[model samples]
Target: MRRFSQFTCIDWSGAKTERPNGIAVATINRDGPPKLISPEPRWSREDIRNWLFHAAKTEQDMLIGFDLSMSLPFHDIGCYFPQWEDSPSRAIDLWHLVDQSSNDDPHLNILSFLEHPQAARHFRHSRDHVGDLFTGGTGRLRVVEQYQRETGQANSASCFNLVGAAQVGKSSLTGMRMLHQLDGAIPIWPFDPIPETGPLIIEIYTTIAALAAGLPKGKSKIRDRVGLEAALQVLGAPSPGPLSQYDDHSTDALITAAWMKNASRDKRLWHPTKLTNEIAQKEGWTFGVF
Candidate 1:
């Protein structure tokens, strides 16, 4: 059996079918570069579900981190479906719809209808973009609260755009972390050392920590240009999802680049609470933070 087993990352673009186009997967074994799995022949929902169930069933302590938004008190995706109004009891009803739909074709299973392709298409096409859950409203908090009460599992998974954008670096960065673990360089914490945080937490956090510790802290310096470029190339691509197979080293490099951007003379406005307060009071980050 492979020591590291499978560390899979997916980029979900909300395609009509199950398999997305820009999807990528990477597997890391004991001490080796993250071998990229073929992007073609994308995986189906059934495949993913089966894999998840199998992993959960067999690996008592398996660490399966997905590059998607997970529902907790702070993050809510159902806000996109204002009509869903009811959560917990009402949310359960919506889950039934998703469950019912998922049964039709295991491959085309929709984990949540609110985040369905149809809804995404409607939003993308419609002139009046509906307010999303992140915008706050639609009683999403109440619904999520009820869900936590019933399931006792606060982490409800959903796809996110940022994960796909940061996939390249995330995948490589994760690979590096796994390698470090194998080499006994770092201890894998139960609380997950990687701290992208929020809905789409990726292993980039680990890479960032590594970079921060190794590189001189000159208000965020660029450690590696090549790695940063690769990361940007992936992020800049018009992809579907934010979760992708990113490597740990490259992930660290990208964080360094972001810091460099922060350190840039043009990016002065990004720092200092006064500028942010002034911007927030006067106009907004849209006018200046760019």
Candidate 2:
């Protein structure tokens, strides 16, 4: 298994504009406590991309996880979008498709893709249609999404669900653009094999990392100093204290970084039972779900 000198978790946001409080990043060095890197002024997705490029140039043997779905669910369907001829066949190709279509929108907004006539039919887009959407609806789930539930974590919102607070579709879309830009620069998990050195990005569900750190369901997000301290102690790390329960961005990032840095050692996580070559290329698995 690959050993990392540093572990990082970014609590990402897909909001239209900059999210100062909503986007946060935390890191745990091989010998230290988790620390926040996100500034008070907030960070743009572009900012995060540039930072990763810098890290790729400077850091050695680093593992950075982003809190977003890296690939859309294509396994059960065999293709991300069925019946749509010339739809992207590979995950990387899918990123390019989104990038090409969303060029007119600033910051790579994927709403254009969502509202596009070709994509609108299958995807339920209205707030009024939330109940019929991916997270709670009768829609078919991807293989990894089924695995997410089998592990006792709350069922993850499908990458197709683009509305509501539970929706991860927007973030996933924005992240795909970043993944596209970082291609060949920073290898992404499941989609590509981890390199022996330099920085690598992985898909992360912070709540899953929280569960692995012994947090209870419905309360996995660490918001308070005590809760953060407890989670860190479980991982044999120390707390810098003064963590906020309300600041979900920093709290999720902090707790996730602590737990994931420790959890990365288990070889089972690196090679999941369901991680076949086809799945790796079409529907990459979440990093901690295995």
Name the top lDDT candidate: 2
Best by TM-score: 2
All candidates: CA RMSD (Å): 14.8, 2.3
User: lDDT per model, in order?
Assistant: 0.31, 0.78
Q: What are the runs in model 2 whose C-alpha is more than 4 Å off?
A: 129-138, 243-246
Q: Candidate 2, residue 74: CA error in Å?
A: 1.2
Q: Cα deviation of 257 in candidate 2 (Å)?
A: 0.5
| Local accuracy of candidate 1 as per-residue lDDT tens digits, 87-132 | 3222223334444434443334343333454433212122254424
Q: Tell me model 2's lDDT, rounded to 2 decimals.
A: 0.78
- Across residues 104-161, which tens digit of lDDT does each residue of candidate 2 receive? 7776577787776666655656656443223346355667888878776546877676
After best superposition, candidate 1 residue 37: deviation in angstroms? 3.0
Total clashes for model 2: 3
